[model samples]
Target: MSGDDAQQHIYKTHGLLLNPIMCGVCGWQFYTLGIYNAHQWMQYGERPHAFRCHAQYL
Candidate 1:
């Protein structure tokens, strides 16, 4: 994971939406579904089933 890769991954992870996504567990809001998913992947990646939510339009 180079710096660029990390940044790109983060950007992709956070899709930059005008309306952010809310965490089902923590109730924290993120810029996009990708951000929430990335958070889950980083925070709960080791756990089975973890957590997830899809973008309503995407």
Candidate 2:
């Protein structure tokens, strides 16, 4: 498989365990979706949401 496909597969496979309100890099968990999204926005500036949880790229 292509690198992109492999990465997508891994993300999909671990998506659930890595809760939407949790940080994949730091294990930080937020209380609500609002809070989580807010944090993501603050860190990632409203784009490339897929990287928010581990948004060092931003």
Against the true structure, whose lDDT is highest? 1
| Local accuracy of candidate 1 as per-residue lDDT tens digits, 1-58 | 7654554566567646545567676788887545576766666553223223332322
The weakest ten consecutive residues by lDDT in model 2 span 48-57
Clashes (N, CA, C under 3 Å) per candidate:
2, 0
**Residue-wise C-alpha lDDT for candidate 2, range 1-58, written one tens digit per residue:** 9655554465567543223357665567864444565676667567434433655333
lDDT of 1 at 43: 65
- Report lDDT (Cα) of residue 1, candidate 2: 92
Model 2 bad stretches (over 4 Å): 1-20, 47-58
